[model samples]
Each structure stands twice: as structure tokens, then as C-alpha cells.
Target: MGSALVTLGGAESVVIERSRVKTLLALGGCVLFVVGSVAIWRAESPVIGILGLVTFGVFGAYILHALFRSGPGLVVDDEGFTDQSSAGAVGRVLWADVTELGTWSHQGANVLVVGLRNPEDYVARLSAVSRRYARVNLSMMGTPVTIASTGLKTDYDSLFALMNERLERSRLRLDSNPPRT
Candidate 1:
């Protein structure tokens, strides 16, 4: 076999990132939202107060959920990377199928990319993170492939190690193939 890394499956692919900073920001926002909502409720405008409460609930849920799930240690399995995969859970690409491994800074962070023959499957998997249905994993003119980042985890080394190991194991095309445009 090729290089092997002990892949451990868990609640998250990797450890939680330093979400404390983000959590503080979100918690601050949630507190403001709750306060604003309560203020509205007491302002003699029941309608506005109700709307504020609803808004508060939405903001609270989003911030809380993001805080809890925003862990570090994102990993790739036999199928695909954890929770990050749009298609399913695990995603594995045959070496022959991948065009290249691209490194690009997305939203201020470096990401690992794997190009594919048809991006439909990959696009579908990233729908939740994409704003539009037609804009999942895309460059300019539309291409099939995927880009997974370490997000805020900042563990590029570990992520790359796993990815490279997985690719070698899968036998994806490498320098032998032509590069991308």
C-alpha cells in the first residue's frame, strides 16, 4: 500500500478550531439581539416586541449551533471529508480521476482542491454552503472538482498530510498529468 495515516473518525473530522473568538462575537450579538427584543417588547409595541423575539430566537439558534459545531480537526475519510462534504459523508477520489491538487486562498484561508471530470456530484455536496443552487464548487467558467479548506482550524499541515496520503493511496494522477489553466 501507499503512505498511510491513522484516520480516526469522530464527531468532527478534526479538533475544534479556536472558535472562542468567533463565539465571543456571536454571543455578544445574541445578547444584543435578546436585549433589543426585550426592549421592543416593553416599548408598548407588542407587534414589534413579538417580531423582535422571533428575530432573537433565530439569531440565538444560529449562533449557538455554530458555536457548538464549529470545532477544529476537519478530516477526510474513505468517502470524503467529514461534515464538510456536500455529496455525502465520506468521499474518495481515484487518482486517475483527479486532474490536480490546487491550492487557493478562499475567504482569506488556504484550501485544498481536487479537480474532477464532472463537478455535478461535487457541486451537489457543497450546496448548503453555497448561496445559489448553481454555484456550489465553481471557478469562473464552471469546472468539476472540490475545494476543502481547514477553515479556521489553521491545521494546514495535518490536513495536507491526510489529503496527500489519501491521494497516493487512491492513485490520482500527479505531475505526470498536464497542469490546469
Candidate 2:
């Protein structure tokens, strides 16, 4: 079971760091894929090789970056959550804009899907590459913000519960003291 570091400062927050062990494992797998892709390219088809290189090679680079990168992968605070878990991460998302929280399964991995009231607002904040990926996520998952615990220290369930709790608290605060007009 994975656990997040919950800080009870002035404002409550959960900080989830990247799992070095999991990241190393992913990097190892990517290296294998790259090696296999190279072998296939030389012994099999150039087209397949190029495809594998393009795909796995790029992914390998990302994993490499994550391996060396420091700081928390995900941070859930009073305002919102910051996601640096994947290439398609959408920096930060406020609780007020989040409409719903749900889960999605992809290739046996459970992803925490955050439904926003105006998804385009968040989508527009991403880069061109991430924007395209976010669009794909929107089409398939009905939201652009999908948090996967692939390299994060916590699992999907833990992340979901923490976010749900924070969102609920934000809602209660908002209800008790409505925002001024």
C-alpha cells in the first residue's frame, strides 16, 4: 500500500513524491523496449524499428527525466493540486473548477480522472504536445485532467481519497461562507 505525506500546516496538504523504485523499473522496461526495437529494426523491418524508436525512445527519455527530477510528483493543497506525474500533466487545478472526481481504467492501470466545469480553460494552459494529448483524454475520459500513479509514491485509490476529501472540504468552506459578488 502506498501512502502520501499529509502536512497539517496553516492549510492541510498532501505531498506525493515520485517513487524512485517504480521509476527505475519503468526506465528498465523502456530500455528493454528500445533494445528490442533496435534488434527488430536491424533484423526485421525498418518501419517497425522506426516506430518503436520513435515511441519507446521518446518515452525512455521522459522516464530518464523523471528519474533525475526532484520534488513532489503531486501536491494537493487547500487551493488545488499540482500534477507533475506525466507528460500530459496540467500543472495545477483548483478545487472550485472541478466538477466531479472519477476513475478510469486503461491497460489495467487505474487513473484518477478529474472532471472540470470548463475543461477547455485548463486545456488551453498546456503546451502544443500536451494539448493534443489532453484532447485525446477529453474525448475518451470526458475530462482533460487525468492523474495516473505510474511513478508517484501513492496508488490510485489513495490519490482519489485524498483529492475527494480536499474537494469536499473546499465545498463545505465555500458553502459556509459564500464568495462575495
Candidate 3:
């Protein structure tokens, strides 16, 4: 659907674009959501019906927008990583602040958990809505910033490998030259 990795400015900068196939799949889900919303409305379930209608309506609208949207889902550079791959993703996590990086699965979806030196500072950058979601992620995954591989153009293995390699190099560079006070 899209290139897995795009090197910008030699091999120093790279961007992982979202998959068109994933976007189509999301669009299909939106259609199902609309259908379910209508079915719920007709089944005399007012409370659940209203919730379904509103929830599905908002999600469907966002999916439609995602279909046409195309950009770097994840950006990795010498500085750090910018995760735009997940819903309410964090913008930047500098290499200096990243202490650990790993992945886990929840509800059949793979989640990438990036351990930060100051997690609270990153959590504070989120908007009101994103902050709410981040709290749930923090509770479930123990890290507010988690990337899921579902909508990404690159597969989980490839993304993880690239990230690990870059992180190692960053750590080595940081270790060799301590920051000036």
C-alpha cells in the first residue's frame, strides 16, 4: 500500500507512511459501524442506541478523513522519534529521554511501549481528549505512549527493528559524548 521506509537526507531521517490497505479496511469498518448504528436504533435500545449512533458517527467521520490522509505515520531521526502512527500519538520523544523500548499485546493488537525518563512531562503535552486516552493507555500498558501496528504501512517486525537499531546508535553516541552542563 505504501513504502515501508523512506530515507530522507541520506539514511539519517526516515518516515513510515500509513498503508492505503489499512485505510480501506478502516473505511469498511466505518460502514459496518453505520449499519450497526442503524440496527441499534431500530431495536428499541434507546440508551445503547444513542451511544452507538454518536460513537459510530464520530469514528466513521474520522475514518473517512483518514482514507485521504497520507503522511509519515512514524518519523525517526538522529534527534528522536515522532510517533504519529496511533490514535492520539505523542509528537516527539528525544533519544536522550528514552530509557527503554519494548512491545506487548492487548486485545489481539500489538502495542509498542516506549519507556521514558520523564513520563509525566510527555503526558502533559497531550490535548484534553488525548490526555484522557493517554491515561487509559498508561493504566493498561504502563506507558502513555504506545504505538499499534494495525494502521501502519510497515509491519510490526520491520518497524521494531528499525527503531531498535536507531535507538542503539543514539545511545552509543550519547554515551560517548556526555551532554555539556
Candidate 2 yields a Cα-based lDDT of 0.86
Q: Give the runs in model 1 whose Cα sits over 4 Å from its true position.
A: 1-73, 78-80, 83-97, 106-108, 125-136, 141-154, 172-181
lDDT of 2 at 26: 90
Question: Model 2 residue 29 lDDT?
Answer: 91
Q: State the displacement of the C-alpha of residue 40, model 3, in Å, after optimal TM-score superposition.
A: 4.9
Selected candidate, larger TM-score, 1 vs 3: 3
Candidate 3 C-alpha lDDT tens digits along 1-181: 3344556666567777877678678768877877787788788776777788788777666556555655677888887888876556778989888888898976666667888888878889988866876787788777787876666777777777777888999989988999899
Ranking by lDDT: 2, 3, 1
Give me the runs in candidate 3 sitting further than 4 Å from their true place.
Answer: 1-11, 37-70
lDDT, candidate 1, at 142: 53
Cα-based lDDT at residue 123, candidate 2: 94
Which residue pairs in candidate 2 collide? none
Output the lDDT of residue 41, model 2: 94
Considering every candidate listed, which one attains the maximal TM-score?
2
Cα lDDT tens digits, model 2, 1-181, are 3555576668767788888898889989988998998998999898998799789888888788768876788888988898888777888999999999998886898989999999999899898978987998999999999988888988778788888999999899889999899
Q: Which 10-residue window in model 3 sums to the lowest lDDT?
A: 1-10
